[model samples]
Target chain A: MKNRIESKSEVDVSLKDLCKRFGDFTAVSDLTLEVHKGEFLTFLGPSGSGKTTTLRMIGGFETPTAGEVYIQGELANDKPPNKRATRTVFQDLALFPHMAVGGNIEYGLSFQGLNKKERKTKALKALELVDLEGLYERKVATLSGGQKQRVALARALVTEPPILLLDEPLGALDEKLRERMQGELKNLHKRLGITFIAVTHNQEEALTMSDRIAIIDRGRLEQVATARELYESPKSEFVADFIGVANIIRGKIIEDNAGVKKLLSDGLEFFIPSKEGFNIGDNAILVVRPERIEIGDKARKSNNSFSVRVRNIFYKGAYLEYYTVLESSQEIRIRVESKSSSQDTSADYKTTIGWNESDSVVLTREPK
Target chain B: MGRVTVPKRVSLWAFTILALMFIFLPSAYLLLISFEPSELEKVPRNFSDFSLRWYIQLFHQERLPGAIRQSVMVGLLTAGITSFLSLLSGMSYRRLRKKSYFLGLLIFPMFVPGIIAALSLSVFFRLISIRSSMYTVVLGHVLYALPYASIVTLVSFSGLKEGLIEAARDLGASGFRAFKDIIFPLTRGGIFGAALFGFLLSLNEFIRAYFLSGWQETLSIYMFGQMKGGADPSIYALAGLILSVSIFLVLVALIYYSFIRYFSRSFA
Candidate 1:
């Protein structure tokens, strides 16, 4: 997945060790991030992972308990939302139900001292920008879901803020509508060239629409990188499990001067081509992506190979995923993908599952 | 979705009619007794002599008329004050960290006995040198109506999405501006309902009004005076008038609200 336009050179928003605590519970802790100008950055995580808390702090809804937030190189920690140069599209769209579509678009301009005529003219222009030019007098309750989304976008954009914060803006829409809106949002971001920082728990949405994704878990930053980098080179077991489906197998590293082997609990040796910062007798976890594993006897194509018993098979439309376990133990899961064109004979039998060292990540685990 | 047994449908209709009759029976009885033609009977037997003879006398009486006027004024003032207080309470309720505790604390006066509240308010008014008059009666009525208003407003606030306010602030509106433009308009229905409830409660209230109103006589006080002076034909006429006016006002408000809603939707 690729963003429509390249992120500009300017740093639009920066956080320096930001922390937010509600009494004894810390919602976001010591988060430092820099969002480039005209970039669409997503904060992706599961519920209660502090992704929303981080976005709310950026939007000035929740003040940081410590540290600071800078927007375009200016301190904005205490600035009220009205004084900030940013806007947000809420999850429910939050269009004023009593107001017409034009009224909603023109709401933010009144505080800027714009005359009514100028406001109306700007509102019309914004509606045109969002492709809702003729819906000035239509009440919000009468609009369709997508139209309401467009109205929300127009409302946020009408103020001409430099950055937009979207807190799960497409969470309420149906799947087909959400996908269409995602495309529209990408195109809108490209056409406007404004920074967009969205917070969502859906990994697919984050991967499909962002220049970079910051994965947060348990009020801490796990990893912040491009979607491909985060998926392929996750630094921790938490990141690997949260980003996508990963089979995390615990083992002990054994070095014999020639090479290193990850000794699995089932007495299988994973021949590691190379690894960093691991000594002999050190516990580690190997994360192999399901799509990267080969489910055949082609051990020459893979750096590390082993055999396991097939436990179950799930038939997805595009591929078949096999869940295999070690012969002596049921702890490790060997997930391998079988495409529709290839016949899979690994079910109900012992089969070899292998992946090259380049296709897996060896992460440090807490020793028992 | 369409499969409904006949017995369930019958039971639902039966329950609805039963509820309606339960609500309307007392009011029908009051209206019928008001047309008793100055008779001493508790129940009206003859429908032939239902007349306005006592109604003319009721209006001609000076004290009763003045009392009704005073009650109306006090009721209106109580409604206004109660609505404003309820608005503040409801907003605070939305903002409070412990909402349930704050809500329970706010409606604490409602749980106490009516006489106890009246006695405590009377003592407090005297200690503050606020003489017992129509203003004090208004104060007491407002206190009596506060819980109803607060409850209604809180319910309305619960129905509203908090995101609207955050969205408004994000759109560059100040806190006051956001509430003035978005929150107030959206919650007006609940406020209106609370105000009506306050007005009706104040109008019917007798215990607190009797104690707090020194020389200023409200409708209930005047009715008590007439009853003490023996059976008065004018009292029935006045009760009938109050009932009719209340019903008419309620009907007018409903019709007017529906009309406004219809037109507002039409414009959209």
Candidate 2:
């Protein structure tokens, strides 16, 4: 009987309480995640945060010490890499230097027992998909970094696996090439409609390419949400700190009125509207993004306001960034459009920073 | 405006001439004597009419031809066996680093002096009631060549880029398929070099052949006997032949090295 997982809409790849241990060290711990069909899910975290390990487990390069992995709804914990219907583009792009571009892409087709002519046709088509149609006879070692990356992609895609795993495939390219490849990869995913699980530590890359980003930390799953949800409303201080630059002010919750909570710092108060599960007298942190901290002499009435002395100013071409030290001794950074810095503010004077209560979030302090 | 100092060329020529004299003098002396027309008891104090009579006599001997044939057969067999076994063992060592200690034990016979190893093997064969012959001589030569072959192959295997294997497997190749398609082709240079070395080693081996041979005499053993029995001009002819063969082997090895260098440089 055919497995029902191949026909399901819920998940194409799923991990259940997965854990990997290398002797005394745990590389990944009790991780559970679901990758939906045709979704671009990214594992984003710092190095050694189990993001790569999780990706390897999904690709069948690693076997979890505990828990199960399901690929297309079939149990794949014991399956070898060759047996799985998943292909991985390694971080180094691992293109075979000994083979020509056509040879490398045609390799997997040979294992399928395709004849020479058929294999060549399929490989040419795959290369054409990456816009490298005429370079099939070129040696891989002679290609540029971006071309090598395209060859790697063509090699993996020629197998036509249901799920494609990319472990920082663009990490080796220069910034401009990386950006271009990122767009090309995203477009390829849309055109092919294959499930793509990419692992990267670059937060911007994750935010730009992923349908959902799973932020991991120190071998544990921190949060998995859409890019906007992770950026605008982070559940933990780690997620907020990891996704984007945010100034975290630690304070004690002084009062809770209905759902809004008022937090007291050293000499100031911050009001956050409707923080779930936060009680009065609880030690919490208020996370405010740098872009949200409004700076000007005009005292616009707002819920959270503080007087800060500008310590330094950075004039970027598009935006002006000001680093200020608040009276409470807390440092805050604010950014405004370069054209918005009027001549009056150009005199480099002290300023008042303000934001609405809903602009900030009260995040629980992570365990030490 | 700037100081100019040329490197001293005196010591360079001194070392070059000294090295050439040290390497070529003995071989040249043998070549000169091999062309001398003289009797067994007479040693030429001065130049005499050069002749090829000794070489002709050396080649016309009945036993010498059989001994040469036996030596060539033994060398070929030793090279084939040593090269095949070393390739397998070396590849295993490369793949399984944890098992290197076991491989070291397998090749430990290489550290023993050839004479001692030949002696030990002789005693072992006698205890097992196995008689010594050309087969035993080939076995002894293989023991001496195996370790050298293994070391050469291991160095070549270590130089390979690990990404090639990973890429092969990622492209749906089984372990065996990857080894055959990628690993073996990339290592052909090392294999050929090792085979040449093993052939030379077996061809020139003297002590091991001396102890292991029974009815048949290897070329080296026969040459040793001829040298000790009497000082003949024909002995000089035989010595010249051996030296020429050694030079020919060296030239072959140089050719192999050049091929490998060209292959790697062109592809790299």
Candidate 3:
């Protein structure tokens, strides 16, 4: 029976307690995620982190060992990939090499039994949607790496599937081309407004393009939030470390009053809102972003401050990285704006570095 | 870079000529002897004494034409069956998790000597009370060709990117449709190679045909019978004819492979 797709709903793709195992190896474990309609959701993680596995489950290319994948409110765990209203732009851009650009894009339409003229028009429209108007007859072999990527995208999108799955689509392109394609893809996502679920190891790409980023590690999801939320208030140490440069300070809760806890790490003490299921005298881990810390005169204004010896200064064009070690020998990195340095903050000596207590987060357990 | 010396160029040309001559000499000798009035055990030494006597005798020979037709039929059937089976199994071969051990098992036939396999198969057929014919010979050749065909097909798959078939299915093609549209087109060259390999191997195979081809005479079996007493000069002519065709097939396969490699290189 034909699965006539219903109207768009609030949630386009819903993965519930999904798990996948290949013999003894668990590729995805108890991963539950909900993707809203028309929002670009990215599963961002390191390789072998189950991000791609989750994407494949959504596309129906993989069957979950446990739990369900729902597309448009219908359970799709048993449905074949072709039966699901999803298309994937694979990492290698698996365009049919023997076919022309038009043929590649028109492949799905052919399966739908569209007539020749209709298929051609639809193929052209899809190509144009990806900004490659005309040149329909160009062989895939002749297309540039970026062009092939666009063709793969167009081909996947031609059928107008409500959700588009991408497995590192810009991975094949060089640095400059990859940057350019990132912008193009973001624009395409905006113009199409489909629920695009993309898997990528690139944190920058996820932050730049995704409406929400799900940080996954070791086959389990660490956290799912907007890019800003993920960067500023990561729930787990893995999410903090994976998304950007994070300095995790191992400490203990010295005291607690109401919901606030006083944390004492090696040669440093600070106050952070107490996490649940933890009390005074319990071990506390503090996560601090490198960019959140201030050095020099500004350090005196913050609630949390420490004296640190400057170990190294890395001069980036936009920002400078200060690698410093506290008297406790706790090494931490601090990022400073290159444009705002009125005086040399690069002295190879002791300096005070600090951030507001609210900027740092205290967790009860160490990361796995 | 230093210029190539005259001696080096000459030596290279000389080596190439010698290699070519060494390879083609036996076939050339057979061809010359077939046209000459040569003895049963001797090759014609003088080109001046060459004639078309062997060719005429070859045409008048009994059961030889039937044997040639049988061999051709068996070759085509075996090649088609072998390639189809290999392509079918080769698809699953890619998805195998324990690929190394399974691949070793798949290629087990190539490890055993052909005579041993033939003998075992013939005995097994006898135990099963199955009569041998051209079909039996075809089956024997299929066993022999399967390993080579699968190897060629699996190599083609290695050159392809992972998840292509999955991508095809993800793009709204069914499993069968994915194979038809994506997998088959991508690996057609390898399938063709398998077919050629199967046909050539079956065409020239003797021990298997000798033991298994009951009530039917394949070309090799017919030739072996002729050589039971003392072989005719006409037999050399037939052998020369078969050798020439096999050579032509080898040339065609070489060109086909080179073309595929060249196109793939350019595409990459």
Candidate 4:
């Protein structure tokens, strides 16, 4: 899939070791990434982790202290935002509070020297693209949160820039509106086929919308890959923890057998396929998702099994989350389907938790 | 939940009485004396019949019309010069990091007492051999009003969100164009309010006019001179007219501002 996307188009923008510093603090450090033509790439990170700063540099709002930026394969480090063929939808929307919807959308076109009739036609078309037709003369302040977001999108798209930058555009909306707008934005991206670079901290949002996700941490790019690849095979412990919830069990590699590796924890042994390269006596951790751990009479036949006392049970609508303490004194959380007939029998009998060898992954223990 | 007890509305009534007494008593006294039969007394003994004699005398008094004309001219000149200079200074102070200390120094004159400022300017004018006139009074008033205008504009400029300007630039506007379209319109309210305040301050100024106007007297100076000659009732009538004019101008400004605000909001 990656090769197919790469073969379809060339790169649109490239950042070469981009670095931004403020006094003694480094905001973005030696970052390099490429945004391909007509692809939706998201920079996923926590606040102050340099995602917004990187976007600002690409948008020409902040100059990189070091390195270069290339737009359409040309060096564009010194170019102002007006010269760059990119428009940004700010986090706050930043719609002109004194202008009507049409006026706001037409402002950029007028700067492009378009005639009044031409600008109005383009603005109405752009508004229609965002499903906000006939809202041209409505006051922006009177619009709801989702409507404001659509107007912001129309304002940016009316300029017909090659790239659209969105800085958490749906962050201010409620959950339901955010979900709906996400679908709308994805559909819009598909229809326009323009390079869309978005910045967000929500893991689900990034996984759901982005064609490729770049996870950043502490001013450094940790990993960049497809959403499924990132979630299924995280490159580092930070990526694993950030992408989703997982039970991380500290252990050391005891043996490497053909393609299977055996790891030893406090008093238990586990097996996993050695795909990430592990040797004997190597310190490792076993990352297991809660849904992958089975709790039933069928647990005895699994490759890795352990006895644990059920500590707590939380009832989710679709699944039951069970917090259990293993014999090794480490607490592990497991999720089982809510339809299971097993009652809270921990008071009478001990429970065994198990998972297949293929479901466990050996990860390097991250340094504190 | 326990019942929530609403607080008593004691301060509201107290403030109402205080506001009325503070704002209305002096004007009421002035109006009462302006209709007095005896022109030399401060208090009026009776109000059997109202007459416009004092108002007639006020308009026809010798030198009063000229004083009013000079005051208006000086006030206009002072407001125009002060607002323009302060706007430039304020914009510079807001945009340039190196001008903060300089702005602080420029604002020092506003904190000085009016009497001291007038005295200092008088000494400086004498050294330069510049005779005092309506222009001199205007210069003194400008010195008094410029700092207020600068402060107001500076606050307005600072309150503006930097992202709005960046958004304009990102939309293909040059730096100057962005400032013209975004910054100027957003700060227009502050500019107008500051200019009106400066005009009012200059019109009602007395100390600077007293020291700077060698022969030609402003309205405030003329009124002060009349106050020393047994409190003429015609002067009270003149004061009442000036107060009414100030109130009318303020009301007009308020109405104009509300109209603009409503239009902007409706179309936003």
DockQ of each: 0.52, 0.44, 0.60, 0.46
Evaluate model 1 with DockQ and give the value: 0.52
Model 3 lDDT tens row, A248-330: 88888876355456888875677775467767788868898999999988898897888889999888879999999988899
Clashing pairs in 2: none
Sorted into a CAPRI-style docking class, model 4 comes out as acceptable
Query: Which residue pairs does candidate 4 place in steric collision?
Result: A139-B268, A140-B268
Candidate 1 lDDT over residue span B1-268, tens digit each: 8888999999999999999999988877766666666566455566676766778778678787689889999999999999999999888877889998998888998988889889999999999899999999999999899998889889878867788998888887788888899888777867887888788889888899988998879998888888789868677777778778778777876886677576445223
Q: Candidate 2 residues B67-171, lDDT tens each?
A: 999989999999888888888876777667577685678679878987799999999989999999988998899889988887887777776766667667766
Which candidate do you rate higher for DockQ, 2 or 4?
4
Candidate 1 structure quality by residue, lDDT tens digits, A37-129: 899999999999999999999999999999999887778899888777689998888888778899999998887788999999999999998
Candidate 2 chain A lowest-lDDT run of ten: A1-10
Model 1, runs deviating above 4 Å: A1-9, A257-265, A311-314, A326-346, A366-368, B1-26, B36-48, B256-268
Give TM-scores for every candidate, taking all chains together and pairing residue i with residue i.
0.90, 0.89, 0.92, 0.88
| Model 4 chain A: lowest-lDDT 10 consecutive positions | A1-10
User: Mind giving the per-residue lDDT tens digits that candidate 4 earns over A132-232?
Assistant: 98899998878999999999999999898888999998899999989888888899999999999999998888888889999999889999999878877
Q: What value does the lDDT take at residue B121 in candidate 1?
A: 95
Candidate 1 share of real interface contacts? 0.76
Q: How large a fraction of the reference contact set does each model reproduce?
A: 0.76, 0.42, 0.68, 0.60
Question: What's the distance in Å from true for residue A363, model 2?
Answer: 1.9
Top of the candidates by TM-score: 3
Q: Which sequence of candidate numbers ranks them by lDDT, best first?
A: 3, 4, 2, 1
Q: Which ten residues in a row have the lowest lDDT in candidate 3 chain B?
A: B259-268
**Residue B19's C-alpha lDDT in candidate 1?**
100
